[model samples]
Target chain A: MNAIEIKNLNKSYQNGLKALENINLSVKKGEIFALLGPNGAGKSTLINIICGITKKSSGQIRVFGRDNEADYKKTRSMIGLVPQEIATDSFERVINTLRFSRGLFNKPSSDRYLDSVLNSLELSHKKSNQIRTLSGGMKRRVMIAKALSHEPNILFLDEPTAGVDVALRKTLWSYLNNLKKQGVTIFLTTHYIEEAENIADRIGVINNGKIIIIEYKKKLLKKFGEKKLIFTINRKNKSINTINSIIKKYELKQKGNKITFNYTQNSKKDPASDLLSELNKRSIRFQDLEIKKNNLEEIFINLVQK
Target chain B: MNIRGIKAIYNFEMSRTFRTITQSIASPVLSTILYFIVFGSAIGSRINDIDGLNYSSFLVPGLVMLTILNQSISNSSFGIYFPKFSGTIYEILSAPISPFEITCGYVLAAASKSVLVGIIILATSSFFIELSIIHPFWMIFLLILISLTFSLFGFIIGIWADDFQKIQLIPSFIITPLTFLGGSFYSINMLPEFWQKVSYFNPIVYLVSAFRWSFYGNSDVNIKISIFAIFFFLGLCLVLISMIFRSGYKIKT
Candidate 1:
């Protein structure tokens, strides 16, 4: 059975704004699924609904095969959520916050486990300090520590590394990877495509309150990833007509003396040798040659735009 | 509400309240001293006796209740409102803590503050006037019950309010006026016949009269009626608060 199942999920605000429309997805256990989207793409809304923080306008949700509405307590205990905002009670100490969070999940207090969590998050030294006195990055770490205190099987991180510095982001990613290795299912939402590309086994792109696509990271990249080869030649070349005819024969675009060839990596036929041989046969000399492969950012933009 | 969750929430809330001990304790103490100087000494000089007791003595129970009521309202409102304003409420909501546990934690913390302030005011009043508790157990019981009732009311207000201005609306517009007109400083008998009839409508009057009866064995309203009124208001506040929690009103989308 899937770790989480969302069926025809829908959410609308009281002001008559529909934030999510018919979202349906299932996450298997022990997998890292990244939900990628732009601002206001309903990523946070979806997380809130599954975490039982927000009421759904319609549809059904289950966690560990338990219905969220009917067995909210059981479902809630199985998941830990780190929200998008940097939220912490500033007056409480770090250790106290973690303890409270653990207890909230009905987990009995264990100093040994709590200490390990604090040590792993590098929050041991700041345990007794007030949260208000901690730096921003430290506070964010405290939030992660709090979420992990209960040893939940499933963890949800909503824009977890947003606004974090490079070093901290790298450390957090490594820590999350370690957690994943320990058999925890991580469901994350992030604006940083690189984070998703680095960590996710599967990627789900959401745009305008709809899930545009959900596919294995490798398969998605292979299917939608576009690469282009560009050739810049002498602008004053007199054999432009001959070049245009040759380019047309090879199905390439020629503007002035410059030519660009677009192709997918998964194409059965290799166009590189053919293009080079054709250029040589036609005696076409290019000033510069460049090949560009589309990154996750480009893929995301293209899907969102669509 | 989960028992463990409630305990966690209660501890978290109590720790936060204790962190601001100076503000929580000093404000009520200072306010009570000022009340004694202005109303007890200055005003009592001319008013003489009220309800067969010295003006200063008559004002003790009312003043203590006022302090408790104000602290209860401010503490509870600020307790919940700050979390909302700072966005920490989202963290709490996301955690496994249920809404019922959250409500109880905040209301109980506020009630604890109110009880502490009540005790302080009662202790300080002894320096200014010869105060005696006609029924010690009743006084303590009524003080706790009143504080809990007001704290719960404040919890509802905090949940319903969106901004700082909205949080202050109840204290400024509703609580302050009701407190002043509830026969805190003077008896309802002093008011004109028509206004006396109107004073009966004020719910705070029942709380104040009940508290006074606990102290002096004298009450402006019947003792049984006052107790009934206190329970009725307490019950009403509890029901409203429970409904707000169950519906996730103002806390959820």
Candidate 2:
């Protein structure tokens, strides 16, 4: 059974705003699932509902095959959340906060474990310092430490690296990957395509309060991901016009001095070879040729636009 | 609902609350001194005794209760409000901690502060006035009960308020006016018959009268009625706070 099963979830605020609608998703145990969306795509709302932080208007949500509402305590004990916004009480010390968070989960107080979590997040040195004294990046790490203190089975990181610097972001990603290796299911929501592309086993794109698609990362890329081939000519030969004519014959777009050919894996014909043959036949000389595969960002934009 | 969780939250909140020792202890002491000097020495001396106790002595219980009520309200309200304002409430809300545990921790912390402030003011008043404890146990009990009651009220206010200004509104608009009119400075008998009847409606009057009864063994209102009023208000606050937690009011939605 999936670690988390959400079926036909719906949520609407009291203000009559529909935050999520008809969403369905199932996350396998120990898999990194990346939920991607724009600013108002309801990613946080979905996470909030599953964590029991927010009430859902309609849905069937199960954690570890147990109904969330029926076994709320057990479900809550199994999950840890690192919110998108940094949320450590400014007056709290790092170590004490983590200890309290662990206790909140009814976990036995283990100073050694708390130390390890703080050390893992590089917060041990500042453990005694008040949270208000820390910089933004440090505070972010403190949040991670607090979440991991309880040693939950499933962890949700909502934009964990949103405003963090590059080095810290990479460090956090590495730490999160290590947590995933420990048999913890990770649900991450991020606007960073590279972060998802590197770590996510499965990707779910949400837009307009709906799940646009959910598929294996590689499979989704192979199916909907497009590739573009661009050629820069050595000279403005008359054959360039012939090349444009050939591309037009195949329903491609061409502008002054450049032509772009877009294709997917299931194209009727191999556009690359066809274009090369056409260029060869026309004696079109080119200085350089490049083929670029579409990234997740482009795919996300395309899906959202559609 | 979870005992261990409540304990943990309580410990954490209490420790943080007491971290700033000077501000937590000294500020309230200074404020109480000013109150005794201005109200007790100046205004209180000119005013005749009520219920056979000197004006300064009469003001002691009320002043102590005032400190408890004010500090209790501010501490809890600020405890929750600061987290909400700084976005740290999201962290706690997202954690495995239940809302009940969260409420218990914050309210306990606020109550602890109120108790501390109450004790400090009581000790300070000993220097200026002949402060006596007619029933030490009852005095302690009433102090704690009043502190807990107000702290819970403050917790509800904290959850209901969205911003800092809103948090302060409770103390400024509601708590202060109720306290002043509740016979903190004067007895209800000093007021006209119509106003005296109206004074009984304010809840703070009960707390003040009960606390004074414990201190001086005399009260303007019936001791049993004051006790009932306090416990009833406490129950009401608890019920409302529990409902807010169960419904996942502002904290979740």
Candidate 3:
């Protein structure tokens, strides 16, 4: 069964600003789905709607095949949400926060489970300490502990590492990957494209309250991925017009003594190979040749710009 | 019926109360004793008795009701408002617990705090004045009922308020004045005939009169009318809270 299914979901604020538009999405069980978007792109709004924090203007949502609104208790019980803000009771003890969250979900008291969650997050030592006394990164980990306290089947993290240092962010990514291995479906939104590249099984890009694209990490990379072939020409004696034909045909760019050609990596035509031979046939000599593959960050920028 | 969910919020609020014990318990107890020393001696000297009851003894029930009313409203309001201000309310809203369960948790915790304070005030007053309860059962019943009602009312205020000042606004400006004018230190009979009629319009008058009757077996308002007034207010608070939850007002949105 799908971990989450949202269809025809639309949300608009009272001021008539549309927050989400016809959002149709599904996250498979036990897979990590990362939503990538710039600020004000409705990524958090969508997650909040699914977690039952923000009321949807109109929509249908199902968690494990049950309508989320109609069966809120069942749906919400199956999900754990780590919100974007690190908002916690400052004076509350770490262990007590976990206990409170676990109890709020109506789960039976299980010190064993709570203790394990604390240990896994490296917060066992700080369990008795007040939340305010913890470092910023540790406090964030505490938020994760609270979300996991209920032992939910699905987890939603909104900008989980927005302000963490690189090393701590990597640790969080590893922890999330471990949860995914445990058969927990993980859904998250992030501004860091590499975060998604490293951990997400599937990636969805949203912009202006609309989902621009959603695809598997490998497939999305192959589909939009581009390769650039650059040739430094020894055009000392050859007519510049001789290379104009190749430039016009392959839509290449010429700068000084170098000509550049761009094409998708997965395309049927091997434009790089064809252009190399054409350069030889035309007697357009070259000193050096280099090929480069565009990364996900470039593709994301291209997609959002489009 | 998320009993554990209710218990979680209840424990959380109660722990906060204990954490600020000086403010929650000590401050009120001190104020109640001061009221006795000052009013019991200063005003007790001026007014000897009212309707055959010693002036100092007569202040007990009204004083208890005053503490319950103010503490109940402030405790519950601050309980819910702090979560909103700190942004932790998102966790509660997203949890599996229903609105009814959430209400029960906060209101019960607030009422429990106020009731405890009320009892302590009564005990302390006994040291200074010869306090008696003609109907201990009714006194206890009225104490709980009043606490629950005002706590629920304060819950509404917490939801309605956007800033910290607004949370204190209603309890300070509305509740405290009504209690003072409702015969907390003096019976409404001391007022002229027209002023007595005006005092009956204040809901706190009904609460204090019934509470006083439980202690002295005498009251300015009919016992049945006071009881009905309390239930009516309780119903009003419940309806307002239900509407707030249903509409996803300040808390959910």
Candidate 2 ranges beyond 4 A from true positions:
A230-249, A252-260, A266-289, B42-47
Residue-level lDDT of model 2, residues B91-184, one tens digit each, is 5665556667788788888898889888878889999987789989999999998999899989888889998889899899988999989988
Weakest 10 consecutive residues of candidate 1 chain A by summed lDDT: A264-273
Task: Give TM-scores of chain A for all candidates.
Answer: 0.92, 0.94, 0.95
All models: lDDT? 0.88, 0.86, 0.93
Per-residue accuracy of model 3 over A1-306 as CA lDDT, tens digit each: 899999999999999999999999999999999999999999999999999889999989999999989999999999999999999999999999999999999999898999999999899999999999999999999999999999999999999999999999999999999999999999999999999999999999999999999999999988998989988988574677877877899999988877888987555777778888888888888899899888889989999999
DockQ for candidate 2: 0.51
Candidate 2 per-residue C-alpha lDDT over A1-306 given as tens digits, one digit per residue, 9 for 90 to 100? 899999999999889999999999999999999999999999999998898778899989999998888788888889988888886777777788888888878888999999998888888899899888999999988888888888899999999899999999889888888999999999999999999998999999999899999999999888788989877766667655676677778676666556677877555757788778878888888777889899998998899899
Q: DockQ for the candidate 3 complex?
A: 0.88
RMSD of each: 2.7, 2.9, 1.5
Candidate number with greatest TM-score: 3
Clashes of each: 0, 1, 0
Q: What is the full ranking by TM-score, best candidate first?
A: 3, 1, 2
Query: Mind giving the per-residue lDDT tens digits that candidate 1 earns over A1-306?
Result: 899999999999879899999999999899999999999999999999998889999999999999987888888888988988888887788888889889888889887898999999998999899999999999888988988999988999999999999899999899989999999999999999999999999999999899999999988888888878889976656687778787787688777657888877666766766787887787778899999888889999989987
| Models sorted by DockQ, best on top | 3, 1, 2
On a 0 to 1 TM-score scale, where does candidate 1 land against the true structure? 0.92
